[model samples]
Target chain A: MTNFPDIASIRKDFPILNEVIGGKQLVYFDNAATTQKPRIVLDALSGYYEHYNANIHRGIHHLAEKATGAFEDTRRRMQKFINAPLSEEVIFTYGTTDSINLVAQSYGRKFLKEGDEIIISTMEHHSNIVPWQMLCEEKGCVLRVIPINDEGELLMDEYEKMLSGKTKIVSVVHASNALGTINPVSDIIKKAHKVGAKVLLDGAQASSHLFLDVQALDVDFYALSLHKIYGPTGMGILYGKKELLDAMPPYRGGGEMIKEVTFEKTTYNELPYKFEAGTPNIADVVAAKYALDYVDTLGKDNIAKYESELLKYATDAVREIPGLKIIGQAKDKVSVLSFVIEGMHHQDIAVILDNQGIAVRTGHHCTQPLMSRLGILGTTRASFAVYNTIEEIDSLIKGLHKAKKMLG
Target chain B: MTIKEAQDELIEDFELFDDWESKYEYIIDLGKQFPPLEEQFKTEENIIKGCQSRVWLNAYMDGELLKFEADSDAIIVRGLVSMLVKVLSGHTPEEIASADLYFMERIGLHQHLAQTRSNGLASMLKQMRTYGIAYQAAE
Candidate 1:
């Protein structure tokens, strides 16, 4: 069993922990869906909306300038946060879905042709899947998916076999949202590069928990959602190698995204703005810095250590509960734990847990294809964050006992 | 004037039945209360994509008032339309434009909904708001 994290001081930072749900203190385990915002993030959002409520880049006024400075500051902060090569490589988009769509629309449209293949793992979220499917359908490209083993780890042999001269792009998630499997992305990147295929790592789940240095990994592209990292909704960042980013065409055409526009001829803006077409979720983007800072303050290693302990505790506790089967037992994993009771419906379990003020994500988790591969409808997923405590896991264990007694 | 008033109406109507199942039965019955929309409104343009239940929504501006006609393939979802119409219909463009949606939470309608269903409701509301904006811009 791993050592329990120092969570007493951490819990004090989150005011929402004091909230009561169904007459019980909320035991929020759905950190994968979206994390609870800390006071720093909330304050940053309020500070922006109340004080610097103006659009960026174009305006020459005071608040506009302040907003513009704050916005670009986030780009630089994100660059250092992920250790990107440069700020220009960072494209602010609307979460992971939008980031993947941007890549598929711009890069896939520009580079991929008929009979060219794109590879992805079976563990990819639907966000990663649908965009490629749309591109493949539009361009006549073939989408070749790398299958995973029963443990939810990518089959490297299959992946190696799939990579050839026909392969153009390989997109895969760095960590599984439903299964918590930490994919061996560095090795995957090296292999893909040897085959001359560009790689895009969906870092949505890994951004908050793992140490991400895009340059060190030499990953072609990386996409992450700020909301899942304890930031506001409707914001995400995409990091690409400068050459590839510059070569890609513009995603959306509008005022901020163009240098010049005529009815007949239009010239797009440079790098990041080429993908970001209109006024963004300015408040959220500025406030995301606070979320990043919050993570930095706690240190990802320390947080991971604490969460690993919690996962082991929960895993061992649930093992004693008869008829509970833990899914995704990959040797290397993050803090997510997913399972199914022998005879209980996932939704029924969720309802009962919610009644006891525990929140766990129950369903396919936008990985219906993965669910099909696993031969199950869905599993109840409880993902951990920095602020989650072992006591919460104890509550979950108690709740499960109640659930088994009531249902079994 | 507020969602509370509408919720009071819902509760009164709910009292005419018992439990969520019978309330749902009443809601489906109320869906039958709406006039069948003209067949032309059933075109692809009116269909709301990404809904688990197939739903069609069409709206037009009658003077300064915005009128909407909606339908759904699912009985349960059509009941949602019934709730929306009672709260949304026969109001001025501005009134329908500025109505508070957090009231749905107060009534606990959205509190129990699946995320996708909640998203669909939000999309339906946004579509209604867009209709108002289009009419206002035209005027």
Candidate 2:
């Protein structure tokens, strides 16, 4: 038996894991949707709202000073977490969707012209797709999609072929949320750069599983949510090359984002504040730094190594269950297992699993087009995080077996 | 009307009707009770965009309350619209704005709805509320 991290010790950090659901300990398999935060991260939230609840960067009061320092500390922490070239490169938004929308509106609207092609893969989330579609509608640009094969891997040759002189941008996911395919983003960036196109990565699913160095990849823009990585909701990071960020237009018109404002004219603020317009989610942003700290303590490599083993174990075990078909069986994958039973509806399976205190995400997963591409209505997706254990995977398999017998 | 009368009216109209099939029949039946909206009102402006079923919502004010008549092509979605109309229509603009819609839980309507279906309903309500807001502002 391989030596694994102590499941009991790890489970202790999350209070909700101890609660009985339907008279059983909760087996949380819905990490991709959102993660259960550690006590430290949770405490950081209450600590912020309770102790230093004030608007950041504006007031000269003591609470405001404290709030400003802690809020900026998160930006610095994110800069280090992603190995971003500078702290100014990090901009905060509501979440991944909001971050992507900022890029689409600011960069895509400004740079893209009529007949310019914006290329994206078929595996992108609706967050990545809809924003660009909105831009294309506004700017009269054509949206080009790179097709995926049966295994859910991007056809790299097809991707390269799709790029041309007219290709203005290439935006793709760093890791597919549904398929768990860890895309070769570096290669994609290099290929796009050769064609004089900027590349943006939807890093929502990759931030926890992979170590991101925005400078190394030379990725033009990267967007991800902190909630999906064990932080609070309503906080996300958008990292851009400083020059690119400096050149882009402001996303929203609000209080914090202006240098000087009058009825006659308005001058926009600097790189990050230009993008972050409103009074930001200060409490959540402060808590988000602790999420990065938690990941840092684990070491990304160790987390990936353990998760890869868990994935293999899950795949092998699930393959044995009769009439169960795992969706998206790519060789390179994160710890996501999407599957469908021969006769059972994904929703029915989810309800049955819930009865057994196993939580999993069911339905189109906000990737309705991908579901259409796969010829399935939806899937039951079980995604793993660093805190998830093989024991949890065992519980999931057993629950499925019981659910099949009961619902089948 | 008393809260109980309103609650009973909603329950009788929505829940006892059962499946979206029966519920939609009730909605189409409700459309018969309201005065006719002009054929010209069927323009794209009155259309609710994200609905899987084609829906047309038209409204007018009667004294202090706003009254609406909505129609849809699909059965279940039509029934959903009927349920919304029952709770939302014939209420003051402020009342419509302030309604918590905890009624969805009572009807067990949203519990059975898919995410898309839920979102569509929410979107339709948002549109209706926006109209109410505009009407109130104009007043």
Candidate 3:
């Protein structure tokens, strides 16, 4: 039997759980969109501003030294968190979208040529899809999509067929944001490597749920948003192989990313800094360590066990409801439950649920292509986080029933 | 009735609900009761694309007054469309262009009008006003 963390105490760490909305207790089931911040993460954000609010990496003064140390410390923490060989492999970005764009612009423009094929899955978020499409439009590369089954699992055989000598890169989501399918990244990376194609995993949804080891997975690139992992918004990490990052050009040319600037010639900085331009999101980056620390304290294994139980409970309960069909039922999935009810619009369901103080993400969820592929306009998704409890899932079930009765 | 009178009637109707649940239930009922727009009128030209739901609105001049017929895939937005049609459908173009919609705020659904909500209500309102101005210019 797996030991789960005390749900009562975990809920207390997130103050927003106590919030009352529409005369009822708030049940936040929108974890996939963004997780609620813990008190420790919040304190870290404020503490940095209160104590050492100064420019990092440039200044030699006490506040600057302290701030820079704290900021760099997050990079090291992230390196260890994802098991990257070098701290320099972790490039801080605005978010996962920014990270993907960085790779698409820097790596794609530098290496990819005309008629080069890039493979992506139907389950990828718009962040992963649009950047490559933009690159393809510019570079004249062919974009191929790996289709999925009705159950939302990626077809491995079809993906194999799409691979060839022309395939330069294969970018796929590690875990689907709309559906909860935890993809087979190990096999995916190995297959891509066989064809001499680089692989980039959109780890935005997977980072919080799965244990990430970049070296073990042998992934060329992995992008994640810290906000979805119980950290502040506007901060993300892009893990690229050291050799690959060194070869790529800088994404944005600015102060931090530059080595020396002359009117005639300019030089770029090393490894991670080449991709990260500007002063960066210092406060959020510094505070993000605490969010990772929070996860560590809970033990990722314990958290995952509890969340899977929650997902199972929710799936079983919702399946019993008449005319409610689940969208994704993969054997392996994260703690996300997406479903569509007959004769009830997803937006209408969201409005009704919101009235009961139960928040579940409704509509296409930035996965319009995935929605279209599934022959659906959208689905009502309730994603669970570490802080969420079985009682909250019960409230969601109750709220959904109410929505059905009223809409019916 | 004038726009102000129509808005007042809606406000009075909303005032009957003691709780948000009842108010939403009434709104959903209004959505069901509202007639669907004609198949021909539900064209791409008439569609207002919101993030969550789509609203299709068609407007024409009935003599001097503007008549609006709208439908939405989402029930709540359809109810809001019904409310918009009730207040502005029978009014002159000049009156509609100048009319202030205060009923949504008075009825405690001003949040729906927020740009961030993206339920098509705000966009639909803009479309209605745009139609009013366009018809006035044409006249």
- Choose the strongest candidate by lDDT: 3
Per-prediction TM-score to the true structure, in the order listed: 0.77, 0.77, 0.99
DockQ-based class of model 3: high
- For candidate 2, lDDT tens digit of each residue in A1-408? 134465566678888788897478888889988989999999999999899999999999999999999999999999999999799999998888988898899888888899999999899899999999999999999999999998999999999999999999999999999989999999999999999999999999998898889889999999999998889998898899999999999968999899999999999999789888889999999999999898887678888888888889999989877899999988889889999888766765675677678999877778878888999877889998877788889999998897676544
Model 2: docking quality category: incorrect
Instruction: Give candidate 2 misplaced runs (Cα > 4 Å).
Output: A1-4, B1-139
Which rank order by DockQ, best down to worst? 3, 2, 1
Question: Candidate 2 has which clashing residue pairs, if any?
Answer: none
Q: Write the per-residue lDDT of candidate 1 for residues A343-373, one digit (tens) a residue.
A: 7656546756776899998778889899889
What is the number of residue pairs that collide in model 1? 0
Cα RMSD of all models vs. native, in order, equals 8.9, 8.2, 1.1
When just chain B is superposed on the true chain B, each candidate scores a TM-score of 0.78, 0.70, 0.97
A30 in model 2: Cα distance from truth in Å? 0.6
TM-scores, chain A, per candidate: 0.98, 0.98, 0.99
Write candidate 1's Cα lDDT for B84-133 as tens digits. 76677666776667766544564456743445552255567678878766
